[model samples]
Target chain A: MLKLIIENISKTFKDKQAVTGFSAELSEGVYALLGPNGAGKTTLMRMLADILKPTSGRILLDGKDISIMGDHYRDSLGYLPQEFGLYRNFTAVRFLSYFARLKGLDKQEATTRVDEVLKLVNLQQDRKRKLKTYSGGMKRRLGIALALLNDPKILIVDEPTAGLDPQERVRFRNLLSEIAGDRIVLLSTHIVSDIEYIAKEVLLMRQGTLIQRSTSEQLLDSVKDKVWKCTVEQHALPQLQKHYKVGNIQRVETGIEVRIVSDQQPLADAVNVTPTLEDVYLYFFNEEVIDGVQAGML
Target chain B: MYRQECYKIFSKKSIYLVFITIVLLLVYVHQLPTDMTMRESVFEELEETWGGPVTEEKVERARESMNAADAGEVSNHTFELRATDYVQFLVTGAAMQKQDQSERLTMLEAEMHDFDEGTYEHREAAIEHDMLQALDDVHGFYLIRSWREMFELIEPTTHVLLLSILIFLGLSPVFADEYTNRTTDLILATKHGKTKLVSAKLLASLSYIVIVFLSLQIINSFLNLLKFGGIAGWDAPIQGISSGLDSLSRLSYDGSPYNFDVWQFFLLTIALQLFASIAVGVIVLLLSFLTKNTMITFFVSSIIIATPALLQQLGTTDGFLGYLTDFSFLKLMQVSTLFTQFQAYNLFDYPVLYPYLLFILFAVVTGLLIMLTYRLFRNQQISH
Candidate 1:
């Protein structure tokens, strides 16, 4: 089986340590890298993709250092950067074919792979359109298609669903699940729902450190009984939020139904609720809450 | 892969616009004066009857034609004018050339006596003496007005400048575009990205330079042919003829150190120009790799490529700046200056000609720049 060992990797930019002492071993499954902004998820991903070298430690693929392996390592690697740009002048087919050649595919193979990936991404109909004309969702799909052009053994995608609509995001998540068989797919994103069903393990990072690595179920278990639900008047909701980590808030005829994460019940009528990846996310990153609510509430 | 890189460069609409500008520049700059065109045609007509070797009999023939025209025996006054000019060129021109070469040799030899035997100055004089001595074997002068005009117009300054602009604008984006587009992460993660990709880009750039250089050259040659009527006397010694135009007089290969025939000298200038263009191109690539901003790369490259020519124009040809200018890309493209006289640099008591040094220096620079560009681009981190 293919295995990518990310050793104690750290990256520093001048006075700032972007990624600090992060380590993980990946093999044959979707590993979701979840973190807040400036948590160094992109930095660690960049190092794993071999686009940036770590300030310390080394990354190895099957025991060989990836830096030393160079192109040999990249031969089986595919990466989609978070804020990537495309050659606006190139058509989808041409862009895929260009990257295919760079990935060491011959002319016929590049042609075949280009067509296959275009079809896989459901972009075959618009394959002839210039990338500049592609919509945001279509461009994201094309980016994924480019990563899969080589059918890489190691796929690293950072914020792949940022601009994708909900339907596109679900389609992408399903696509990632279907393609994760026998391949290491490292997915980094803020959308917990994207990885809830597909992720074999979720890696949580904060301030350039990988704080937790566990399955979605196990992570939810950590926040079990910590999540509570109760209805409160609109005016009292602010006081309730101040004492607990508030998640999703809903409006009801009776009052405001709020989900809160706390070690103890915050209200006399509060009932313990089942935890979700979003609750677990809030529980772990509760310090990021403002005005008693999570900044990016699901 | 190579084809793809070439496509990237040639596919740009901006390159085509640059080419259009170049063609327009060539046309505007190389326009031949109306009188020169008339004189060239008259000389061609005169060559029909008087086109043989330059001898006393031929001189007498031309004299007779002029006298006849004065007596109204000849129909065309233009024909008379050409005949008179031809006689003066055939008789007085050769005698004056010989006297000038002798006087120059005397002056140089006397100057040589002032320097120590093993010094660079002494060696320089000795080299010029040898170059001047080679002119003794010149067979004879001929009706080479067309060839002379062609040689005199082989000014590569504007062509090189236009070429630098093309390369600067076209290639400054070669590596910088990858970074600007944020495609570096995707590309660097590919199999051939680090190795063959660099090679492909470099080869494509060099091919572009060659094709562009040839296009500019073909346009120049065509314009020169149209301006000078036609290229003739290819086999005539470069020392055989001189232009009457004040602007072209300095380019009169009459006292050139090299004994190249007209065609040989023409080809040499073109070869030197192509070399300098490619050298400038490689330097531009290095700049592209260093500064990942196309505008910055283009700006700095313009400064680097234009400074030498600017300095030369400002009369910085005597001190340290002069030494730098002598070996600059502009100087190499100014092929006529290198060959018009015997110019050399002293290397460990050995004299090396400017052309040889030009090739050696730029070749080394090209090689090193290629390596540096490759290393920088290949090893660059895509943090941004």
Candidate 2:
């Protein structure tokens, strides 16, 4: 089995430490890197993609240092950056063929692979259109297609579903799951739902440090009885929001039904409910951040 | 990869637009004047009447006809008189140049006696004297006004400026645009990105320069041909063509040391242009890698390419400043001045031709810039 070992990886830019002492061993499955804005997920993904050299670390693929491996490592690696631009004047077919050539594919193989990836991304019908004419969703799918052109062993995609619609996001998630059966896929995203059904393990990052690495069930188990549901007056929701980490709030005929993530129940009618990855996200990230701000305001 | 890079540069609509602009400018500048056409027609008649090897018989007949026109002995002799006057000037100038060379040779031989036989000064004087003696006598001319005018029009400085603009507009975005468009990360992640892709980009840039430079040349030549008539007297010596012109234009080729005729000199100017274009292309690419902004790269390249001309215009062509401007890439592009006089640099005890040293220095600088550009781009950190 192919393996990628990221050992003691850290990246510092000037005075700011973007990623600190990040280490993980990944093999033949999709690992989702979960982090909020400014959480260094992109930095870590960039390092893994080999586009950015880590300040002090070594990334190894199949027992060889990736930096030393160089092009040999890139030959087996694929990456989709959080943001990118395409040659606006090139048609989808031409764009893919260009990158296919850059990936070291010969003319015949490049033509064949371009057609296959276009079909895979469902861009075959629009293959004749210029990239400038592509919608954001279409462009995102094309980006995914570009990443898969080489059938890489290690695939790193950072926020791959950021601008994707809900249907497209689900389609992308399923696509990742289908492709991960034989490769190590490292996906960095903040959206819990995008990885909820597909990720083999979810890694939570906060302020450049990994706080948790567990499967969905295990992560949900970590926040189990901490989730409670209660009905409260609409006007009292603000106070509850200030004092607690709120998850989902729905307007009912009586007033409002709110889901709360907390260690202890604060009301008489509140009942324990099953936890979700979203509640976990709120529990780990939102609770501390909202509490600090609420405390400061008070 | 190389083909795609070429596509990226050539596909820009601005390139075509700039090309059209160049064509229109050439057309506007080279419109044929009626009076010049009539005068050249008369010169053609004179060439058929008395062409080749400025014989004494032809000179006497031209003088008699000119005097007849003055004495009212002949009608409609104005055009014939002017053409003959031009021939007379050519003969006089050639004799004067031969005399000047002889006097200078005598002076050099006398000056050499004051220095030791093996001294650098003695060697330098001997070299200068020998170079002056090597120049061949000015040959005869036949309907050379068009060729002469075309030679003057192909000024190196003007064309170099035009070349710099075209190169800047086409290549300033080679590496910088990738950064601007947020595509550097993707390209830098590919297997060939740091290696073959860089080479491809450089090759494509040079190809673009050649295309632009040739387009400029073709347009200028085609329009000038349409306006100025046939390129007659192509084999005439450079020293012969400038004769009979005004004093200002007369000094254009006053003492050129090279044995090249009109066609050879034109080819040398084109070679100089190609060299200048490559040097400018290399610098533009280096700036693109360094700045990562297209407009910044363009403006900075323009400033660098134009500084020598600007300083020269500001009267800095005297001492050290003069040497600096004279040996620059701009001066290299403006090639006529370099050949106008035999100038040499004293390296140690030996003298190297100034034109030869200019080419060697730029070739080295261009090679170094290419290496620097590759290193910076290949190892660039895509932090953003």
Candidate 3:
């Protein structure tokens, strides 16, 4: 079954367009929403979670429009907002239990589910501690645990790994990859690396519109020859940066070395280099148009 | 859920501070010396300020000056004698003085000043009667003096502290904490987030209010009864009824007094205070939802509760606003006034009108507040 579908969705805040004529569909896998800050990735996810209503358009779950479903639609949906707010005075166990009850789990079921999710997030050891005493990563993990309380079929997490250290980030990614097998997980982030490994498909958003939607392999293939590397004199580096899209720069003992993305070779002794997800992100985001296509599409 | 909310209140340090403050106030009131001591002190001060008591030498000199009496002098003399002393003298003198001598003396006074009129006698008798009436008036003054002192000691400590603190503490945090912690998003996202959650908060606040109110009321009652000996029957002669009655007739009930059983008044005051406190609690909770800060909630509730009392203390000669203070909930909780034989006014006797009005107003305002909170939550954009 199609877990979620957002049809020609648009959201406006006052007079400003936040998300304009956005559309997407997801089913039983990890879907990454990639965007820069203020690109309306969070706004789109919020509409899908039913936390907000689109100014115009429909959000559906299994072919049923969720905007009209009210609380019944929300029962199977779990969301972790960009900033997760937990009561400082509540212990982790108490906090999760409260959310569980709110998710309509009965007492025994709430207790069991709280214990299960706490263990899943590796917070079982610290479950008795008050949230105020928790580290930032631990708090984030608790937020994820809360999102999983009802075993939701459609999980929406916004900037889920913004503050996690490397090890915790890898663990969180693994956790999501494990759970995404038979569920639809929409993960939104500005950090490219969080979704690079686990995401089944990536949706690139820029200026309130989805500019690109493709598999990770396809995104890299589109930018292959455009990326080139070269060794140059220290004085030649600044001019190279001004001319081409410089993806990375490093200083070598003999001189300055640089990576730049462009249609033609722009430097002497330049060699082709493999593009990264970060490079593709910048290419689409920085370029006004892709040849023969409208500026809105890639 | 309500039980958990109650636990939150009981465990809070602020609630303990309020509890301790109430207990200390009650203890302080309980330790006040008996009302007789207060009356005695007043009597001594009044005697010193307005020439000492009527002395025998003063009375004798006034009596000998007979019809040199400006008839005002006769009335003044009649106030100087003690009622007991004059009654004893009248009973004994009937046997000792000749009927003819007494008749001649009466006839001379009748000719001099129309003493043949009923309820009057010759110069000597009039002087004695004036002295007796004066004594009776002094006695009645002392009775009222004691009641007034007793009334003052209990009212402010028990009623004012209990009601205000309970309302303030119970409602101050209702919406402020949710906003401060940014948990309104999570709450509003739930199935019963809008209706059940708001209702739970209101119910929790009222539960705390009742607990605090009852605790203070029970403590105040126990302490008050411990300090003042139990006395019943509070209906007292209304003030301004003494002008037409004769001295002997007025003296019959003058020194006799009654008190509203303190327990009954205490319970009634508690009921009034509870209603008023809950009404204020609801209003303050609504304000908390709007303001979303505890400090603002505290200040706003304080002004709402204290404005009337402050106006009352400024006194009634200030006009209509002053008169309006009589209907204040703060003023109505003063049950001790019901024990006084004479009140400055009948303001406290009327059943509390404002508390009922406020109760309805609170309900309407809280209903509106819940609706607003629900709407805000439902449409809330979760911010990082």
Candidate 4:
């Protein structure tokens, strides 16, 4: 019965608009906010977190304005910002207890919850260690543990896997997938593969606007038969890149090989290939390459 | 929640370091007046002056010799008399306050001797005869006691200075650290972040102030007892050991109305001082809540706490300007000022006196500051 509806949301900085006329209604599922740098994913998540008041919009939790709901709204909401610093002197367990108290948990309950989250994040052994001694990945896991302290019905995590290693990222991805069944988990990331197989819905944003919303397969199916593989001479690669949206580029034994998204074949020898979430992402957000790195790569 | 906040403050070594430094300074400052007490040689000097350890007979003989016309001129200066061992302790210390006002003291003593129809006291007595009526019973043969002179004149200033520094350190981080630590987003998103958590932090800071104030009070009182002898005559009249007296029984005319003994006045001074000290803590917290920067809060708070004493030093301490200092935050810290019955101010059409008016002003301001601290801390946005 949990619902969050964001309507006509816009955030304008002094000179530029960070998010504009964005709207969405979310129930319970793992919803991925996929975008390139400066796509307003963090801005949107911050608004939902209720830390940043919107310039214009209403975020309704179960049909009541979240701003008026206040503590009632905060009780059910858990947020992990893109970057936050832990109080350096506090041991992990003490820090968790501080957050639990803020969440209105009593001492006995906070202690139990702290132990539970520490174990869930695989930091139970290191609970007594000072946060300054924790590795970056361990700190990232600690952030996730804090976000889970309330067992919030609506969880908002911005760039949750940013500092984690590949192994830790996989573990986190699986963890989020398991926790998303009953909560409205809004996960924002630029990594297409992180949520490719896990998210129930993928929200594609470009230039501060939601360009597309679809199921994982449906997002890929939109570009089906439109992605093709072609090989060309190394000297002709730049020319080929200009005509089509290139996703994966690799060196071949003969000519250079490239996978691209185009409505029709660009060459007589081009063959259709199944599209990845990455290919779809490149088609939508990587049309303009910068500094020889594609937007999706960034 | 309060215990959790207490843990945050108590677990920090920096707070403990500050507390220890202040306590050591207290021990050193409290030990300062020990040599001024009754040493064996000082008592011997009294024996030499009066031909024996001072009994009433010998004291009368010494007074006769000093007042005799043949007595050698004492340099137009009021030299210390060979008082009883304990009274000698009070007189030597009381001389320091006279030393601060020697220019005025000499003028007043000369005026007392003139006794002309146009003399300042004669004219003042005629103008405010009713106010001056109480001097009818004020007469000869003065008595003396320690009067908390050694402790009041010295310790209260040291107490205020050290207490302000400690309060600034304890409260400057009450709200500002959340900004520096980047814990604002997490806290602002919590259910009790704006209300209950802020209340807990303030309660913790205030609890610290009260504990430090009471500890310093008890320690300073005990030290005064050991260093200057017990306040056995603490209940004696202010006239007993008052500085710059015109007659044996004549104390400060302004203080005459209250008729409070030194102990009673000292108790009131302690109450006013503790209120002002805690108010200082509130000022630091309010500044920290607004600026969200601890360094700015400390330096600014220090400037405010120091300005009053500096102004009293630079400005005239007699007329309108002196009366003005009674209302200052630092002026109350000097407990000796509370015994000066010479000044009264017209506050709100009622003649309010020092120490009493100061207490009311501090209570009002501290209450406002508490509300302001809560409002600013709760409403501030963590947009960064």
Q: DockQ (Cα-based) per candidate?
A: 0.77, 0.75, 0.28, 0.58
Once superposed on the true structure, which residue ranges of model 1 sit more than 4 Å away at CA? Answer: A289-298, B28-32, B38-79, B106-118, B136-141, B145-154, B246-250
How much is B339 displaced in model 1, in angstroms? 1.8
Stretches of model 3 off by over 4 angstroms after superposition = A286-298, B34-162, B229-268, B308-384
* Ten residues in sequence with the least summed lDDT for candidate 3 chain B: B240-249
lDDT per prediction? 0.80, 0.80, 0.64, 0.72
Cα RMSD of all models vs. native, in order, equals 3.8, 3.1, 13.2, 7.0
Best by TM-score: 2
Q: List model 4 lDDT by residue over A60-168, tens digit each.
A: 9989999899888999988999888888888999899999999989889999999999998999999999999999999999999999999999999999998899998
Docking class of 2: medium
How far is A149's C-alpha from truth in model 3 (Å)?
Answer: 1.4
Score every model by TM-score.
0.91, 0.92, 0.71, 0.81
lDDT of 3 by residue, A1-298 (tens): 7568889999898887989999888899999998777789988887777767788999888888986777777787778888757777789998888777677788899999999999988999999998889998999999889888889888889888878888888888999999998889999987778888888999999878998999888898998988888888988877776567787788988787888788898766899989888888767765543322443454
lDDT of 2 by residue, B151-261 (tens): 433445556666677788999999898888788888888898888888999999989988888867776766666666767767877766553442113335646666777
lDDT string, candidate 2, A143-193, tens digits: 999999988888999889989998878888888989999999989887888
Clashes of 4: 3
Query: Would you list the clashing residue pairs of candidate 4?
Result: B254-B341, B254-B342, B255-B341
Tens digits of per-residue lDDT, candidate 3, B173-277, equal 777877787776666556555556666677888888888767765675566445433322232222211211111111122221222232343344456556656
TM-score of chain B of 2: 0.87
List the candidates ranked by DockQ, beginning with the highest.
1, 2, 4, 3
- The deviation in Å at residue B230 for candidate 3 is 4.7
Model 4 chain A worst lDDT window (10 residues): A287-296
